[model samples]
Target: MIAETRIALKNAGKYKPEDISTYIDLGGYKNAEKALKSKPEDIINWIDEAKLRGRGGAGFSTGQKKRFTNEAICDKCLQKYVICNADEGEPGTFKDRIIMEMDPHLLIEGMLIAAYAIGATKAYIYIRGEYTQSISKLHIALKQAKEKGFLGKNIFNTGFFLDIEIKLGAGSYLCGEELTLLESLEGKRGYPRIKPPFPAEKGLFGMPTLINNVETFAHIPYIIEHGVEHYRSIGTENTPGTKIFTISGDVKKAGYYETSLGVTLRELIYDLAGGIKQDKKFKAAILGGAAGTFVDHTVLDTPMGYDLLKERGAVLGSGAIMVLADDRSIFEMTYSILDFFKHESCGKCVPCRVGTTQLLLLMNQAKHTKSDRIELLNKLLAEAEYMDQTSLCPLGQSPILPLKSIKQYFESQF
Candidate 1:
């Protein structure tokens, strides 16, 4: 058995993405029509019952987010927005790009359902600039959807209107942050806004907004078509439905694989991804992306789910599993991750701005004594913890995850 589920990626690599006829034949827009006729609260309730969480790094409740936007006190602004976060810039993560490239219509259908549920008339897809093929495919798909009346005014004669626009990002990793994405979509520099006025209250031109990743949106139509009970039956009780994992680095099959949330890491590597490359022993795996924690080989049997991994100080962040072979240097890998964060820090907060620079400088110093290196490492970890508490947005706080996890699991390499 493959021991994998194909919910979000069901249409991927199985049909021509540019053709609407191909998508329609596979029951593409059927759930979208269902959503138009159903009450928004009914859809939200079903999602809540199914326990569908965000496929984004946060793992927040998707139904709760929609409910918040629906019930938000938006007296100041009458309009609401729905955003598709297609900016798959996280290192070792490319699942969203595949969906946009190979199954663009699925994303469109999911977005329509979400918009209808949240009562949002306007939506935006903030895609990465590097995704030329995905963008092109989404463009064609959007045009087809509009022409077929799956989008635009009076969709399916239900008097519901939703217009989705595409905004290409300039490859700023910080733009993947929901607030920063809103700023970028509004033609401002990509900098994260402070919390207290969360996106559910004020977002996207000072209006309520519901933001979710491409994969999170893609599951909506499936959950709506298939009952919530059916969706819940696939995965564990807490994290129901399937997840799309992007395995890279030393894996033999370095690509996307969709499976239930609670599958063992051993099965994912050996059974699904053809095991480590060159028959080498697995030294470690970075669950999630650069902002994710590192796991040693001993934890290969650990279940891959949100709550299960959280107990081990790990995350299924965006479903990225970067396999590291024994030959790979832990120091070099840590340095590379730190470098990405150093370059991508938005500089809006002092803790993140200074912490990333200080960490990089300490790691770059080659002439330090052994004791000095250890002392510097301790200070860098302190700084990372401080950043986690004080940083304005997730970009500033992300450095702590890798730094702390690497220090815990691979400190001897330092």
Candidate 2:
């Protein structure tokens, strides 16, 4: 079995939905309250000292993001907004859903920490529409938070008043991008805007907004209570803290598992996920999500995180690790992933919008001729190369990378 560590999911699968006291008792809000009392620069210092990186796809430094948010909020004279991106659209990624549904108060506490740290007056939890149970749980916990004065005006007798709203996303995958998410929240079409004026500068109706993944915010209380050193002790020195991964596909014990930053994919699968079911042969593993690259069984021993995976031409994209056993067909899986991209492509860029359909058409015709399959493979590579270089945002940019990586690294069925 894998010797995994837990942090963001600390209370997950171990707490009642409405148990605010359990959260408080388990060291929640201590960080936010401390941050509320401490100097803002000190808070930024603590974050940078801990070396906490974003758990989102980009894996940016959380400290730097917070510093930027603090600066933006101060300059704009805009009441900051804290948003929890619980719209886990990547297939094989279920950590966010597990977090929100299992320990709703943890999500709430995470939001509160952000509000305190950034001087945010309001917060929003953007959830996927498919998370019915998670939404119900959060709603109850939210009411409890408001009634207990943890969320309403002047929290904990401090001048920080934070009202957290739970917003339901219609599950448009394009909205997973921060800017696109803001547009969707405003009841507009969920399409990404060009960057330069990032969300930290202009977000949520031109306010300085700090958006974080559920797990990233969840680490704040722990960091405050334990100090930066304590948080750094568990994971790699630079990439400190544990990451929650959602392992799926034909594994023996597929589920969510939390491990330190340097944990290997082999340790996660063969040990934590109970290896291939019935000890079936391994074909390949998709690190991150469908947007991530593929790795063969030999490379499964590689570590799972931001830096190491990049060395392998992949990324730890949202901690969604999917295992493909020998019995599964790569053609079918690749096609399904491409189709999902097509449906969620937002039509904002021509490369992703038209390119996906063209790839699909070629794949459909590949059933008859070998040359057709090879031609489709070449086109897939070309499209991915172009998309990565020219697309407006990551939505179109990443749709084809996984397929191209799979084709290059793994033996796909023609």
Show the colliding residue pairs in model 1. none
lDDT of 2 by residue, 36-55 (tens): 77776787788889998988
- Cα error of candidate 2 at position 257, Å: 0.4
lDDT of 1 by residue, 15-57 (tens): 7898898899988799999988999899999988888899988
Q: Go through the candidates in order and give the C-alpha RMSD of each one to the true structure.
A: 1.4, 1.8
Q: Evaluated with TM-score, which candidate comes out highest? A: 1
The Cα RMSD in angstroms, rounded to one decimal, for candidate 2 relative to the true structure is: 1.8
Question: Which candidate gets the maximum lDDT versus the true structure?
Answer: 1
In candidate 2, list every pair of residues with a backbone clash: none
